[model samples]
Target chain A: MTSPAITVDRLTKRFGAVTAVDDLSFTVAPGRVTGFLGPNGSGKTTTLRMLLGLMQPTSGQAIVGERAYRDIRRPAQLVGAALEASSFHPGRTGLGHLRTLAPQVGVKDARCHEVLELVGLSGAKKRRVGGYSMGMRQRLGLATALLGDPSIIILDEPANGLDPQGIAWLRGLLRALAADGRTVLVSSHVLAEVQQSVDDVVVIGGGRLIHASTLLEFEELASRDVVVRTTDYQAVETLVRERGWSFDAQLDHHVVHDVAAAEIGAALFAAGLEVHQLADHGADLEAVFLRLTESSDAPTTQFTGSASAAPAAPPAPAAPPVDGTVAPPPPPAPPTTGGVA
Target chain B: MIAALVAEYRKFFSTRLWWILAIVMVAYLAFIAGVFGFSLTVDTGADAQASNFLSPKEIAQSIYALTSPIGYVFPLIIGSLAVTSEFRHKTVTGSLLVEPRRSMLVVAKLVSSIPMGLAYGVLATVTVVAAGAPVLELVGDGAFLGDGDVIETLVLSVVVMALWTMMGVAFGTVLTNQVAAIVVVLAFTQLIEPIARVALGAFDATSEVSKYLPGAAADALLGSSFFSSFGGEGGGTDLLPQWGGAIVMVTYILVLAVVGRLTTFRRDIG
Candidate 1:
């Protein structure tokens, strides 16, 4: 099978008044594993569905190998996808399920056993899917996706029901698929779930593109912030604003970005303020993801400018943390993402 | 196209539903045929009405044709399930992934349901003959299996079964919800249509229209029915000729299949 790049060119899907996918654009190049990351209800599945031609885009297009999915001569052989693990007839055995698909995929019955073995489901090939555990069903779903040995593999939340070992196995398998020059797009709400497998990340929130870049570039957006709590809140807030450090002032504490915990502690000590707590709250990928998606509207331009310059961009002071520790200001500019075409 | 057809057949045989429904259909047809054969042939001293209205041969032919009138529901259900089960289970995603052409998938489903319908037809016919012939031979005239009209009705019964199954597939394609499709099939075939046909046939004006109903068309296609043998021309409506019945059933299948293809079949699988 030929490896094909998937391109979503301003694809938009509006369900009545609500837009599920709002002019989202991203190109998934071949020979790399790309993570389609977003929180739940962020239109990740809608984008994938449009890409697979399982859904209609309101406007624009999703092109696979330069053609719409419906126009592909043999789509399964070109793009193997498993959108849901539960998309199986419970009465059918794993092998039976594969056999039903094998003929349409233009593969021999022997290929069914081969995929079952590939997904580590050979032993339970004869057992009905109704009796299979969620993890086993996930394996079967992976097996189904691998049936045609397609070069472009799209799996939506494949690791949702897997155990640690299964997740490890999936990571290895995804890496191996990309190593063979396939374009693998695996989507998940949690960035860490696919952190080890994906080479690039395309993040979306509220049906709009928030960030798209290499994983290394995305990780570089994780800034080191210092959370400082003190009795002299007025003085600390004045110092933070005076130093031009981006910060979010909570009711009892302040999260100061682009500054070390030691620096904040020294500043507090010099002011003779009673420092109750000072800790380095190193912003990890999860935190960066939350920051970007939580204030998705504000960061749309901030992150999309360039990953390297993302840190230097002014942080939205009003963009509150998602932990619900503070009442966030009302978000502004709902549909002003730069990717709108 | 051939690959899609093979895939559809593989889908059908992979489930236990076909055989389970087959068993239910066999028992139903056999019990109904046996009971009817016994009651119609038995010498009730009240009146010689059974013998005077129709010959033992005509009665025997009617019993053989019972395969279509009473047993068509099984093939109908099988056809409906063939389409509805895929949607119910969301396997249409996998199906479209392989074929990608929605129209081709619908065509494959329509074509594949034919052999399934034929298989059900043969099974239902065999059950009727196996259970009904013995009762007919013992108390009434000899089992007229070789008679031309009986043989014709049996063959037509098989064709009728195949048509009914195709109709089921078409109907299921239009009404994709599994519960709704099955309920509609059972209620229309078992309750609504029968009652409607009788109610309509009770009048001279509507009796002609009642013969055009699906069940009546199927019975008309088979060229005989025990219900018609007793009530012919007096209380019951006259069925269309065999060719006319075939045309009517084929029209139902074609119309339903077309509507389903243009509407639900073309809609996004999600």
Candidate 2:
């Protein structure tokens, strides 16, 4: 990859009375796909425009590698971008459009054909873009960005109009590009597709960053919890209350968090209560994303991106090992950076 | 800036718009030349106002009028459409993305207009030769073809047409709205400016400043026009000399281009 990272530091953009992006900071690390996720009108497009130098930021800057975007010589070659699907003239063919931009980055004519082939638009190279479907226009946008063989690719809603098969193709293409050690940042409002396509995610809402962390870490935070069953649930609840641990008391079992299952079991057995079942509960990314974004108006809602436990804060400290007894519970899963607020 | 220039050329030529407009322009110029030639060829009565004493000079001067009305407007459209179409089509987004520097892109667009003007100039020149020469011959103005003054008039028209095209580019850049720019250009050059010239000639007060108007200055550079005779003598007499008129046309381009560049920075193309 030509650049090691793209750092958007303290970026803010305001249009008259409305603030589009507000003091947002994030790093798109090289050799991985970082999904830029936000609800509609959350300033995702505005932030990308600033990164591409298409708009002036109200404050701060976006830097690719070592230099600011404007300072980079041959930016088209070093950092490829498709800011919008309909940015090309309709009368021009897909090939014609790419050919027009190919020279700006010193790309040869034949390479324009090569990019057309790469994006699967070789057959429609001579056809006017007005005749192409939205899916085809997206492909053409990709081809134009790829014409320079740029090491950094920034795509905005690349999968908006793609068919199921096309999305799968894009999934593979993005993986391949990232695997080639290039920095890839793709933005999308469609959270499901991003969850599948990206290795890392930067979630924003209401013009502020909600979270920035590895996808695996995000999913782990969303899913980390336990369910326990006991003959005397009253006794277990009594112990949980005494220890000030977190748990949801259900009709049969208790959904517990912030304390390990073994600790719950130890506390229960110490009270002479018999433990029948204990299991971890799993929550998907969709549930976590919904809970975080939907709580925009209701600050009282418990589920929040900012309220998420930080990675450095241990949810439960491990208890000392007992002699010739059940081992002390392993610490609750280590919190990775990000979540709620 | 050079890369942006290349990209602009590619943008114009890569589409069917340039070639399509060019073909139509060529046909229109040919038709105009044919009509003008045919008119000179067959007029049973040469002059109705005066006795039948139409000179070769009058006919030659009549041909020069086509240089302003027919020639200036077409090249102006070419320049205006090339810049304005980008806004209409929302293709300005891509142009800015590649270059990023607004001034560089604006300057390149203005520079590209020169070649467009040159192309139209050559076509109009060829039309004058193919159609005007033979007709002028039939009218016993064969000497008009070889006349240094006539040749200089044609050359000046070509140069002036290029300047007008640059003005069209400036207008398009400043107004980004395609229909608005076209309307403003047509009204100012054809309707407003010409009508104002007529009003100036009628009244004694505004006649001096009317000669400085863009269309009048362009006419002044052409040296002779049917309007010079039809509109009366004082209108032509008060107009700037050929060189001064050319300067006025260039000033219009500079003013509009600077305005466009300033506003472009503030425009957030979403």
Provide DockQ values for all models, in the order shown: 0.78, 0.55
Worst 10 residues of 1 chain A by lDDT: A305-314
Task: Count steric clashes of candidate 1.
Answer: 0
TM-score versus the correct structure, for each prediction: 0.87, 0.83
lDDT winner: 1
Cα lDDT of model 2 by residue, B1-270, tens digit: 777888888887877877776677767776776667556545547433211334676666556546665667677787888788888888887777677777877788889888878777766766666666677677645637667877787787777777877888887888888898888877776788777877785567877777778877887778765456444445444668888888888888999899988895457777
The per-prediction i-RMS, to one decimal, reads 0.8, 1.4
The 10 consecutive residues of candidate 2 chain B with the worst lDDT sum are: B46-55
The positional error of residue B177 in candidate 2, measured at the CA in angstroms, is 1.6
Superposed by TM-score, candidate 2 places the C-alpha of residue B240 at a distance from the truth, in angstroms, of 1.0
Clashes of each: 0, 9
Q: For candidate 1, what is the lDDT?
A: 0.84
* Residue-wise C-alpha lDDT for candidate 1, range A62-170, written one tens digit per residue: 9988799989887788889988989999999999999999988888999999999999999999999999999999999998989988989999999999999999999
What does candidate 2's lDDT look like per residue over A166-219, in tens digits?
A: 999899999999988888999998877767779998877656676678888777
Can you tell me which runs of candidate 2 are displaced by over 4 Å?
Answer: A223-283, A297-306, A311-339, B30-54, B232-237
Give the alpha carbon lDDT tens digit for every residue of B175-262 in model 1.
Answer: 9999999999999988888787778888889989888898888877887754577554443557898889899999999999999999
